[model samples]
Target: MSILDDLRDRGLIQQVTDEEGLEKHLNEDRVALYCGFDPTADSLHIGHLFPALMLKRFQEAGHRPIALVGGGTGMIGDPSGRNEERSLNEENVVKEWSNNIKDQLSKLIDFDDAKNGAVVVNNYDWLSQMSVIDLLRDVGKHFSVNYMLAKESVEARIEHGISFTEFTYMLLQSLDFLRLYQKENCTLQIGGSDQWGNITAGLELIRRSSQEGESAKAFGLTVPLVTKADGQKFGKTASGAIWLDEKKTSPYEFYQFWINTDDRDVIKFLKSFTFLPLEEISELEKSNTEHPEKREAHRKLAEEMTQMVHGKASLDQAVRISQALFNGDVKSLSKDEVALGFKDVPSFDLEESEKPLIDLLVEAKISSSKRQAREDIGNGAIYINDERQTDLQYNLDDKDKIDGAFTIIRRGKKKYFLIRH
Candidate 1:
């Protein structure tokens, strides 16, 4: 299948400016395409995977991919999906975020010196140098006030309020497409469905700025906005946004996010988020339908995504920790693995000593009182390091610690506690 066909099969394509023309252009030449990412945060989150991976898809199809860092546009912020106007970040902060976003993009595409190697460009390089007068004359004149206001992005914010800085954002993005088309021979721009307006604006700018007729012009495509079957948003967990950076969200945590995907969403996510072949995904889909409890699709999606975003070593570590936790083999986990497994569980810090299990349970608040703790312990309801302890005098010591850093306690089947020394 062609690249566009594959995208359609994956349900990635939402809207395209010129489907037939764009298909012919892609098939006939080594087209250059660009996707702009606004650096609103230091790290790109799970929400960014679609377009980031789309760049890789194009590169794999022998096309050049230009990952545009919105250093200039980011300062003004895109008002596409927001309910209110965004508070602008400082130049220094946006600059730092731009650099971080560049690094994140590098992880998703090949930047090696080859024919189809990806290239990273910052809009600030050109946009920052243009004077306000030059912007108004060169780019601003192309966009009419009525045309700008008609866009969904601006229209949504009209009642709440939209600032002039935000109102002029379409011009800046259009300038990006125009500049890329002129300098890099870029002919296509892609982004999320929410960016359809911006993407088309860029295409309009490309046509208006060019001396060529309809035979030669830029195009735009957008991936569908992700949604959940349960009426919740994709890429969100109880904790918050799942970031690409390991520091913001650990590999284990990220893995858990995918592994826990609702069954209804897993197969769709496997299609959209993973590079696995259609045949393999079909087999997994069949397995999922036959045995939903096994959750084969969920495991595959989690494994593929975790390995892609984090390295093999990190994915391996995450799996090791997950398996150990699941098997009740908590004692076998290393110190770092313990930290990752119990990072969010109830925890307490205490000095190491030969404290009776009942007293420790009471102190850790695993039980309401010493009497209740002793009663639970006598009934074999308390466990240390996954081992049942029925003796009321059972004491926790250094030997009970996992790698001498922490101890895991289970008050019942579902409740887990972590004690640090």
Candidate 2:
């Protein structure tokens, strides 16, 4: 199937300037397309995955994909979905963020140039050099004040007020598209549904600036805004945004996020996030309905996404940590795995003296009171490193410590505690 067809099947396509024309252009030539990402943070989060992965989809279809880093536009945040104006970041700060984003994209796209290799470009390269007079005479002259005011991005912020810097974000983005069309022969721009206005504005700038005038082949496409069935935004957790950067969110955490996908959302996510074929996905969907208890779809989604973003080694570690936790096989976990598994669980520092496991459980507050702790122990509901401890006087030793750094404790089926030496 055509890449566009694949995206449509996956429910990725939301808005397109001209569906027929885009399909013709994509099929007739080795079209070059781009998606711009603003560097608002040092690391890209899961929210940024749609466009980045979409670029990969295009490249796999034998088209050139240009990943545009919005260093210039990022300095003046786009008021696309915000109710209030954004605070401008320092020039150096935006530049640093731009660099970090570039590094992250480098891993996702194949830039080897073996066959239509991907490219990363920074808008700051050209936008930073353009003078105010040049911008006004060349690019700014094409956009009418009424036209800019009517766009959804600016219209929403009219009540609260938006600064001139942010108001001009669309123009900067348009300039990026125009520059790419002129220099790189790029004919398409894709982004999230929120960027439909900016993408179309870019198409407008390309058409007016081109000799083709109104007949320019420049087009725009946008993916649907990711939303969950539970009425919450995608890519967010109780902790906060799930960052793509491992340092910001660990591979294990990222895996856990996808592994815990809602049953209602699992099949849809598999279609959107994984490169697995439609046949395989359909089979998984059938399995999802037949054996919902197994959570096959959820596991596949987590495995595919974790491997895609974090690499094989990290995916393995995530699986190991997850399995160990599920099986209550704490001894199988390494020190780092222990830390990753119990990172958010309650933890206490032992005084480096021998303490009964029951005392430690009470001391760590895993049990509400000494009576409950004793009762839990005697009932064989307490576990020290996955081994049931029925003896009320069981004491923790250095051997019980995983790597001499931590000990995992389980009080009953659900509660877990960590003890650090």
Candidate 3:
């Protein structure tokens, strides 16, 4: 199947400037395309996966993909999808973030292929060199104020107020497309739905500036904005945004995010995120319908996503931690796994590890008082490392510790506490 057909099957295509022409262009030769990502933060969030993965998809299809890091445009923040002005970051901070984003993109796109190897470009390299006169006379003159104001990005911000800096963002982005098309032989530009206007503007700039004029084969495509079935935002949990960097969002947390996917959205996510064959996905869809309780599809989604982002070792660790917690076999987990598993659980640091069980319970706030602690112990409601410890006189010892660093305590079936030495 053509790449466009595959993307359509996965529901990735939202808007294409000219579908027939693009398909022809793609089939005629190994087409070059690009997707721009602005470095607005130190880490790229899950929201970035669409375009980044889109680049990967094209690369796997034997096409060249350019991953553009907006080191320059990031300073001027795109007004697309915002109701207010963005606070600008310092140049050094933006540059640092740009580098970090480039590193992350390197993980997603293979840059070593001899034929269709990916390329990472920073707009700052060229955008910084262009003077204001060149920007205005050479590029800005092509876009009129009336045309700019008519765009949804600028139109929406007119009532709330928009600065001149933001008003000219489309022009800057147009410059990026023109520069890349000239330097890299790029013929396609893709982004989220919000970037439709900017993408088209770039196409316009390419066509107008080309010696071939309107016959320049430049095209634009945008993917749909991902939304949750529950109407909540994608890539967000109670903790915060799901970051691509492991330091920001651990592999365990990332695994859990996909594992907990809503039944209504799991198949859609699998189609969009995983490279699983469509036929296999259809079977998974059948399993989802016939045996929703088994959650086979959910597990597959989690496994694929975890392994893709964090590698096999991290995926195994995440699965091991998950299984241990589910089976109430906390002792089987390693020290690092235990730390990752109980990261959010209530924890207490022990000054001494030799206290009586009841005293320790009271000190750790697991029980209201010594009397309650004794009652809990006598009632078989207390456990140490998943083992029932009913003895009222039981003393905290090294045996209770996992790897001699931490102990897992349970007051009842669901409430758990971590004790650190």
Candidate 4:
């Protein structure tokens, strides 16, 4: 199937400027497509994954992909999906973030393919060098004030107020498309649905800037904005946004995020996020319908996402931590696994090497009082490292520590605490 057909089957295509023409363009020759990612933060979040993966999809289909880091436009901030203006970051800070995002994109797109290797470009490289006179005379002349104000991005903020810096963001982005077309021979620009206006505007700039009798063979496509069945936003949990950087969101946490996908959304997500074959996904979908309790689809989704983002070793560690927690076999987990698994659990630091279980429970606030601690122990309600310790006078020693660093304590079935030494 053509790449466009594949994307349509996965529900990835929300809008295309000219569907028939774009499909013909994809089939005619080796097409080079581009997607822009603004470095709004040091690391891209899950929200940025769709476009990044779109670039990967095109690359896998034997097309060249250009990952554009909007170091210049990032400083100006795209007003596409906001009701209020974005705070501008320092130029140096934006430059640093641009590099960081470039590194992350390197992981998602293969840059060593020799024939169709991906390229990363920073828009700041050109946008930074253009003087005001040149910008106004060369590029700015193509856009009119009425045309800029009519765009949804600018129109939405008319009442609330948008700065001149943000108002000209579309022009900057259009300049990116035009520049890429000239330098890289790029013919397509893709982004989220909110970018429909800007994407088409870039097409306009390309067409208008073309030499006499020259046709600008450019197209714009956008993927739909992801939404959850429950009406809550995608990629957000109680903890916060799921970040691509492992330091911001650990592999274990990231795995758990996909593992807990709602039944209604699992199949749709499998289609959207994974490169798994349609046949395999169909079988998984059937399994999901026949035996939802098995959660086979959920596990597969988690495995695919975690491995893709964090690598196989991290995926395995995440699965190990997950299984250990689910089976109440915390002792089987390694020291690092324990730390990751119990990261959100209540924790207390122990200065002493050992302490009586009763006193430890009281001090750690696991139990309200010494009497309650003894009662909990006697009733077999307290556990140390997933092992039942009914002895009232049992003392936690170095042996109780997992890897001589942490002790996992459970007061009952689900409530857990971490003791750090």
Q: Please name the candidate that would achieve the greatest lDDT relative to the true structure.
A: 3
Backbone clash total for model 2 is: 0
**Residue pairs that clash (backbone atoms under 3 angstroms), model 2:** none
lDDT of 1 by residue, 1-421 (tens): 8999999999989999999999999999999999999999999999999899999999998899999999999999798999888889999999999999999999888988565656999999999999999999988888899998999999999998989999899999999998999999999999999888888888777777788845556899999999999999888888999999999999999999999999889889998989999989999999999999888899999999999999899999999999998898988889999998898999988786778788889889999999899889988888899999898877788889889899999988889999998
Q: Which pairs in model 1 have colliding backbones? A: none
Quality of model 1 by C-alpha lDDT: 0.91
Task: Give the number of colliding residue pairs in candidate 4.
Answer: 0
Of candidate 1, the 10-residue stretch with the lowest lDDT total is 208-217
Residue 169 lDDT in candidate 3:
96
Better of 1 and 4 by lDDT: 4
Model 4, residue 272: distance off in Å is 0.6
What's the lDDT for all of these models? 0.91, 0.90, 0.93, 0.92
Worst 10 residues of 2 by lDDT: 110-119
TM-score of each: 0.98, 0.97, 0.97, 0.97
Best by TM-score: 1
lDDT of 4: 0.92
* Model 4 misplacement above 4 A: 212-214
lDDT of 3 by residue, 1-421 (tens): 9999999999999999999999999999898899999999999998999889999999999899999999999999899999999999999999999999999998888987675666999999999999999999989889889989999999999999999999999999999999999999999999999999999999989988888789998999999999999999999999899999999999999999999999999999999999999999999999999999999999999999889888999999999999999998888888988998898899999978687899999999999999999999999999999999999999998888898889999988989999998
TM match of model 2 to true structure? 0.97
Error of 1 at 295 (Å): 1.8
